[model samples]
Target: MSARSGPRRPAGLGATTRAGLKPAIFVTLVSVLAVVVAAIASAPFRSSTNVESLLFQMAPLLLVAAGQATVILIAGIDLSVGSMMSLATVLAASGSAFGNSAVAVVAVVLLVGAIGGLANGLGVLSGVNPLVMTLATMAVFRGVALLVLGQPGGSVPSGLLTPLTNVYGHVPLPFVVALVAIVLLWFATAETRWGRSLYATGADERHAASAGLPVRRTILTAYLVAGLFAALGGLALVARIYSGDPLVGDPFALDSITAALIGGIAVTGGRGSVLAVVPAVLLLSLTDNLLNLFGVFSYWQYVAKGVILIVTLWGYHAAGSPSGLLAMARSGWRARDARAARGTKA
Candidate 1:
C-alpha cells in the first residue's frame, strides 16, 4: 500500500456536504407538515382564495425572515430589524401625509436601513460584541420611531397602497415581491462566490480569513443586505395596515427569529436556506389560523404559540439525536396518520 492513499479526503468535505443537505431535508419535512396542518384546519384552508390571502399576509414576514436568516448565517443577529421596520412605517406614513410621494418614501426607508446596517457592521468590526451593538441600535431606532409617531395612526400614500395590496393576474403584488426576494436571495446565497464565502466564514471565521476570503467585507455585506430586506418588510407592513404604528414591528424580531430557526437556520450560524422559510412561514400562519378557528382566547394565544415553538424546537435542539427535525416530523406525520385512521373508522 502507498504510504498515503492517493489523496486523503479533507475531513471537512463530508461535513460540509452534510451541512448543505441537512437544511434541505429539514425544510422538506416541515413543508410536508404545513400542508397536512392546512388540510386538518379546514376545507377553505386549502383553497386558492385562502392561498392568495395567506401569501399577502406572509409577504412582509417573508422579507424580514429572509434577512434574519442571512444575519444568522454569519453568526450574527440583528435585533433592530423590527425597529428598522417600525421606522419605515412612520417614515412612509409621514412622507405620504406630508405629500412626499410614494417613490420618496420608499427611497428614504431603504436608504436609512442600509445606513443603519452599515453602522452595525462597523461597530462589530471595531470589536464590540455583535449582540450588544445591534441591541443598542435597536434601542436607537425604536426611540426614533416613537419620536416620529407617538400614536398608532398615520397615512400610507394611496399610490403606494394600490400596487402593494392590489392584485395582478390573480396574484397580489406583495406575493410577487416576496417571490422576487426569495429568488434573488437564493441566487445570491447559492450561486455566488461571495455567498460561498459567507458559509465558509460562518463555519469558521479564522479558517475563512486564512483561506484568502474577505471576512470583514462579507459580514458587512450580510448586514447591508439584511437592512434592505427589513426596509421592504416595512413597506409590506404599510400596505397591510395602511397606517403607521410605533409598535407595528414589535412582533417581527421574535417572529422572524423563530421562523428562521424553524426553517432550519441555526442560531449558531453557517447553515440554512431561504427556500426553507417558505414552508416555515406557512406553518406559523397555519398555526395562527387553527388557533383562531378553535376559538383560543386572545390572552391564551401567546401561551399556545410559545408551546408550539418550544415543542418543535425541543426535538430540534436535542444534541446528537440524528436530526431533531426528523424526529419532530416523524411525530407530526404519525399524528396525521392517526387522523387518517380515525377517518377510516368513521
Candidate 2:
C-alpha cells in the first residue's frame, strides 16, 4: 500500500519536536550540561560556599549582560558600558563624600551613565556606526573617571553596601536582584509592544521605518535603558567591593558581550531574549570558579576563555537558524538532486 508510506508517522509531532529545539533552549541545555561537567570535574572543590561564591561572582557580569543584551537586540553595540560603569563607580564614591547619602550617590552615578548613553545614542542616530561611537566614548569616559578618581580608592559606607553584598538567609541579594531584573527584562521584551517594535527594527530597519515605526527614538531609548542598568551594576559592584575603583569595570564590557553572545543573543540582533543570558553568565562564572579551584594560572584561564568564546560563537553562527530552515533544506535538496543525476548518468 504505497510502500507503507514511510511508516505513517503522526503529522504534527515532527513540527512540535522542531519547535522544542529552539536555539535559546539549545544554548541553555548546553550551559546546564557544562555546569554539570564542571561540578563533577571539580568535585573536590565543590561546596555550598563555592556555589555561593560563584553566584556572587556572576552578579556583575549578569547585570552588564542584561544591559548589553538590549543594545544588541536593537542591532547595536555599546563598547562604552564598561567605561561608563567605571565612571559611575568613581562618581558614586566621590559623591559619597557628601555624607554617605545613598540618594546622592545613586543620582550622580545614573547621571554620568545617562550622559554617556546619550552621547552614544546621538552619535548612532546621526549616522555614526555604533562601534566607533562607543569606542570613542569608552576612551572619553575612562579618562574622565581617572581624572575624577586618579588612584582608584574610595570607601563605601557599610550601611549602604552590606545589604547588597550579604546573603539573606542563604540567598544572595545581588543574585535575587539579578533574577528580578531578568524577569523584568523578559517581560519588557516579550509582553510589550515596544519590545516587539525593537525586534522589528533590528530585524529590518528599513522596513520598520517604512511602517512608521519610531526607529530613532526606539534606538535611543534602548541605549538609555542600557545606561541605567549599567549604572545599577556599578552600584552593585561598589557594594560588593566596599570601594569604588576607577578601573573597576575594565574587563566587563568585553566580558558582557561575550556572555551575551554565548547566551544565544545573536550579534546581528532580533533573535534572543534576556532570559538566555542568565545561563551564559552562570556558565562563565562556573568555569572561572572551577579554574580557580584547580589553581590554574590567570593567564591560562584567559586563554581558555578566549578559546571557548571563539568556539561558542562559531557554533552559534553555524546553527542559529535565524534565516529559517530553508537554506538547510535547499542544501539537502541540491545534494539529493546531484545524487539523482549521478545515478542516471551511471
TM-scores for all candidates: the values are: 0.81, 0.82
Model 2 lDDT per residue over 1-346, tens place: 1111111112322322232135556667777887788778877545778777777778778888888988987779999889888887887777557678767677777777777788888999999999999999889988998998897777665566767678875567878888898779867875576775676565546545665777888899888877877877887777667777888888999998988877666576555677777887877776677778889887887787777666665665567443212223433434533533343344
* Candidate 1 structure, TM-score to reference: 0.81
Which regions of candidate 2 deviate over 4 angstroms? 1-21, 40-44, 317-346
Best by TM-score: 2
Cα lDDT of model 2 overall? 0.71
Measured by lDDT, the strongest candidate is 1
Candidate 1: list runs displaced more than 4 Å.
Answer: 1-29, 40-52, 96-99, 298-304, 307-346
lDDT of 1 by residue, 1-346 (tens): 1101111113333344344445456545765776686677678776777667677778888898888888887778888889989988898888745576888888888998899888888888888888898899989989999999998887787777777788775577877898789778966876677776776665456556766778899999888877788889988888788888878887898888877777667565556666667767777776676666566777776675566566555645553322224434544534533533443344
What C-alpha lDDT values do all the predictions have? Answer: 0.72, 0.71
Clashes of each: 0, 0
